[model samples]
Target: MNRQDIGFVQSSINYQFKNLQLLEQAFTRKSYSEEHPEVQNNEVLEFYGDEILDFFVTKMMYKRFSRILNNELVSEKNEGELTKLKSILVSKESLARCMYNIGFSKFLYLGKSDEKNEVYKSKSVNEDLFEAIIGAVAADCDWNYENLEKVCRTMLDMETTNGYLALLVKEKSHRLGFG
Candidate 1:
C-alpha cells in the first residue's frame, strides 16, 4: 500500500504503525501476493495472531472471572463458564462482526479478480483479516501487554461478551437460589 493508504487506516484506527509494510502485508491475501510474487501474504501473520489472541482472551477471562476462583459463595464462577465466555470472545463470527463494526472491511486487499467483489464481506474473510491486522499490530509493537491490550479492547466486542457472561452469571445465580 502507499503512504496514503497506511495513513488513512492508521488515522481511522487511531494507531500508527512503525512499519507500514507490515500493515500492508496484513491486508494482502494469497491471491494478491500470488500475482505479485514479491509481496508477502497474511497467512503466517494470521496464524501468529490467532495464538496471540487466544492468550489475550484467556487472560481476560481469567482476570474477569477471578472472583469465581476465590469466592466461597454458591454463585462462584466455574471453569466451564470461563471457557464458554472465552470461546465466544475468540470465535471467528465475533471477530468478523467486530471488524465490520470498526469499518475495516474496505481496507482488505485481494487480487484483481476479487478486488471488485465484496468477498471480504464474508464472515470468514473478515475474521482472517482481523487476525492479520492483529498480527500486523503485534509485529509493529512486539506483543507487549499494553499494545495487545489496546488492540484487544478496541477490536474485540467486549460488550457482547459481557452480555453473554452476564447471562451466565444470572443463570448460575438462579440455580444457586439467589435469583
Candidate 2:
C-alpha cells in the first residue's frame, strides 16, 4: 500500500503506531511476506490481538452483566462458547462492516492477483485485517486496557446492549414462541 493508503487506515482507526513498519507488517499477508523474507507477517500480531480481544470481550461481559450470577454466565466459561461469541463479534463480516462503515476498505493492500478474488471481498478477509490492525495499534501505541476496551466496545457494537441482556431477553422470548 502507498503512504496515502496507510494514512487513510491510520485515520480510520484513530491510532497510529510508533513504528510504521509494524503497521505495514500488520497488513502484510503471509503470501507477501513469503516474497519478502525480511518482512514479517501479521500472524504474531494476530495471536496477540486474539488474546487481547478475548480479554476485552470477557471484561466487557462481566462489567455489563454485573447483575448476573457467576454460574449463569454460561458463555463466559466454555472455550467453545467464547469462540462462538468471538466469531460473531469479531468475524470478518462484522469487522468488514465496521471497516467499511469507517471507510477502511479503500486502504487495503491485497496482492495484485488477489485484489479481485471473491474471497478477498469476503467478511473473513475484513475480519482478519481488523485483527491485524488491532495488533498494529497495540504495537504502535500505549494502548492500555481501558483504551483497548473502549475500542473493542465501539467496534463490536457492545455499547448498545450492556452485556447482551436485551438480546438474551429477546432470544428467550423467541425460543418460547413469543416472536
Candidate 3:
C-alpha cells in the first residue's frame, strides 16, 4: 500500500502501526498469500485477534456491569444476558458494520479471484478483517492493554455499542417494572 493509503487507514482507525508490515499482513487474505507465496495471510492474526477481541469485550462488559461490595464483585447482568450482549457486540453483522463505517473494504488485499467475487462485500470477510486489524495492533504494540483498548474502542465504535447496550438494559428494566 502507498503511504497515503496507509495514512488513511491509520487515521480511520485512530491508531498508527509501528510495524507497517503487520498492518499489511492484516489486510492480506489467504487467497492473496496463495498467489504470493512469500506474503503471509491474516488467518493466524485473525485467530489471535478473535481471542483478544473476546477477552477485551468481556472485560469491558464486566467493568461496566460489575461492582465491588463487601469485597465481592457483583454483576448487574446475569451470565446469559452478558453472554448475549457480548455475542451481539462481536457478531459478524456488528463487525461488518464497523468496517463499513470506517470505509475499510477498499483497503483489503485480496487475490484476483476474491476481487472478482467481490469478497469485500461479504460480512464474514469484513468481520475477519476487523479481527485481523485488532490482532495487528496488538502485535504492533506488544499487547499493551491501553493501546489495544483504545484502538478497539475507536475501531469498533464502543461508544455506540455501549449506548445500544444501555438501551437494552433500560428497556428490560422498564419491562420488568424495575426502572
Candidate 4:
C-alpha cells in the first residue's frame, strides 16, 4: 500500500500511529512476512493485544455487572462466566464484522493465493487484523488507560451501532443473572 492508502486507512479508523511501519506490520499476515522478511507478522502483537483486550473487557464487565455477588459463585464459575461474556465481546465474528464495516479489508495485505480462497471472507482473518492493529496502536502510541478505553468504546459503539454486538452486553448480563 502507498502512503495515501495508509493515510486513508488511518483516517477511516480515527487512529494515527507514530510509527506507520507498525500499522503496516499489523496488516501483514505470516505469509506476507515470509515473502518479505523485512516486515513482521502481527502474531506477537496480537498475543499482547489479546491480553490487553481481556484486561479492559474484564474491568468493563466488573463495573457493568456490579450486582453479581463475588461470594456466591465458585472461582471456576466466576471465571467461566466472565470468559463467556468476554467471548461475546471479543469474538472473531464480532471483530471481523466491525473491521469489515469500517472498510478495513480494503487496507489489508493478503497473499495472492489466499485472496482467492473462500476462507478469506471468513471472520478469523479480520479478527486477527483487528487485534494486530490494537497491538500496533498500543506499541506505537503513548496510549494510557484512558486513551485505550476511548478506542475500545469507539470500536464497541461502532459495532453496536452496526448491530454486530448490539445484544452482547445485555445477553451476557441476563445469562449471568445480573440485572
Candidate 5:
C-alpha cells in the first residue's frame, strides 16, 4: 500500500502504527510474499492475531456479562453458555462480516492469481485480514492491552451496547429460539 492509502487506513481504523512495516505486513498474504521474497507474509501475524482476538473478546464478554456469568442477572448463564456466546463473537464468520463491513479487505496484497480471482471477497480471506490487522496492532503497540482492545472495538463496531456484537447476540438468540 502507498503512503496515502496507508494514511487512509490509519484514519479509518483510528489507530496509527509505530512501525509502518507491521501494518504493511498485516495486509501481505503468503501468496504475495511468495511472489516478492523480500516481503513477509501475514500468516504469523494472523496466528498471533487469532489469539489476541480471542483473549480480547473473551475478556470483553466476561466484563460485559458479569452478572450473567456470576448468576446474578435474571438471565443467568453458565460457563458453557458464556463460552458459546464468546465463540459466536470470535467466530470466523463474524470476523469476516466485520472486515467486509469495513470495506477495506479489497486492499489486501495478494498473489497475482488470488488477486485475479478476487480472493478478498472470500469469507476466509476477510477473516484472516481481520485477525492479521489485530495482530499488526498488537505488535505495533508492544502488546499493550488497551491499544489492542481499542482497535478491536473500533474494527468490530463494539463500542456501544447496541453495536454489532449485541446485534449478533440478538440474531443468535432468535435463531436458537431463545429470543
Candidate 6:
C-alpha cells in the first residue's frame, strides 16, 4: 500500500501508524509476498498477533470475570468455564467477523489468482489478517500495551454487545471493573 492510502486504514482502526510500512505489511498476504519477493508477508506478523490476541483476551477474561473464577459469585465457575470463554473470545471466527465488520476485507493485498480463490476470501483469511494487523499495530506502537489495547478494542468490536448473554455478562462485568 502507498503512503497515500494509509488514511483509510488508519481511519478504520482509529490509530495512526508511526511506521507506515508495518501497516502495509499487515495487509500483505502470502500471495502478494510471493511475487514481491522482498516484501515480507503477514505470516510471522500473524503469528505474533495470534499470541498477542490470546494473551490480551485471556488477561481481560481473567480480570473481567475474577468474581466467578474466585468463587465470589453465587454461581461460581470452574476452570472449564473460563476456558470456554477464552476460546470463544479468541476464536478465529470471532476475530474474522470482527475484522470483516471493520471493512478490512476491502483492503487485503491479494494477488490476482488469490482474488478468485474461495478459501482466500474466506473468514480464515480475515482472521489471519486481523491478527497480522494486531501485530503491526503492536510493532507500530513499540509494544506499548495501551496502544495495542486500543487497536484490539476497535478491531475486535469489543466495545459493544448485542446478544442477551453478552448483555448479561457486560452487566455483571461492572462488578469486576469492566465498566
Give, for candidate 3, the lowest lDDT window spanning 10 residues: 158-167
Which tens-of-lDDT digit does each residue in 69-122 have in candidate 1? 355424245778767777777777788877777667677779987776767888
lDDT of 3 by residue, 79-163 (tens): 9979888888898988888887777889899999999999999999999999999999999999999988888888778334854
> Tens digit of lDDT per residue, candidate 5, span 45-130?
99999999888877787676665535555434578777777777777788887777767786799999999998999989988988
TM-score of 1: 0.80
Residue-wise C-alpha lDDT for candidate 2, range 1-179, written one tens digit per residue:
78888787666555655788888877777766776678788888877777787778667655643445666543333566455554555555566777656665555555555565644566666667677877776776666766566556655552223334555676579879998
> Can you give the lDDT of residue 166 in candidate 5?
77
Clashing residue pairs for model 5: none
- For residue 2, give model 2's deviation from the true position in Å: 4.1
Model 1: worst 10 consecutive residues (lDDT sum): 67-76
> In model 6, how large is the Cα lDDT of residue 63?
63
| lDDT (Cα atoms) of all candidates against the true structure | 0.77, 0.64, 0.88, 0.72, 0.82, 0.77
Q: Can you write out model 4's per-residue Cα lDDT over 1-179, one digit (the tens) per residue? A: 79998987677566777889888888888866777788788898787667777787777877665554566522433666667767878888778888877777666767666667744466898888777877777887765676567666666555734442446667678889997
By TM-score, the better pick of 1 and 3 is 3
Task: Select the stronger candidate by lDDT from 1 and 3.
Answer: 3
Q: Quote each prediction's TM-score.
A: 0.80, 0.71, 0.91, 0.77, 0.83, 0.80
- Candidate with best TM-score: 3
Q: Candidate 1 has which clashing residue pairs, if any?
A: 68-77
Query: Which model scores highest in lDDT?
Result: 3
Candidate 3 residue 23 C-alpha distance from true site, Å: 0.4
Cα shift from native, residue 174, model 5 (Å):
7.3
